[model samples]
Target: MVVQTRADVGDKSQERIADVLRQRFADVGLDLGDDRIRALAAEVAGA
Candidate 1:
């Protein structure tokens, strides 16, 4: 697993974070839904 901070990705929006997470998951052949991705992104963003 890899980890990155908001500064690393250069964006703090939930949509952007979700996109990053979505791509990372896809890199490993795993697909997540929007709701799940958003939830995870929210957690990552501390929302």
Candidate 2:
């Protein structure tokens, strides 16, 4: 979602995508760790 959003907005920076993922997930009630979220974001951004 984050990567798609980045592509939609013409922003592909991994750091920016990670930041977006963090902010988006922060509003959710998920139990994932920050490190895990970052890893997922990196993986998605790399793809």
What tens digits encode model 1's per-residue C-alpha lDDT throughout 1-47? 22563545535887788888888888889888889888888777778
lDDT of candidates 1 onward, in order? 0.74, 0.65
RMSD of 1: 2.5
Worst 10 contiguous positions by lDDT, candidate 1 = 1-10
Considering every candidate listed, which one attains the maximal TM-score?
1
Evaluated at residue 27, the lDDT of candidate 1 is 88
- In candidate 1, which residue ranges exceed 4 Å CA deviation? 1-7
Q: Give lDDT tens digits, candidate 2, residues 1-47.
A: 65565565334666676677776677775546778766866776665
**Candidate 2 Cα errors over 4 Å, as ranges:** 1-11
| Per-model TM values vs. the true structure | 0.74, 0.55
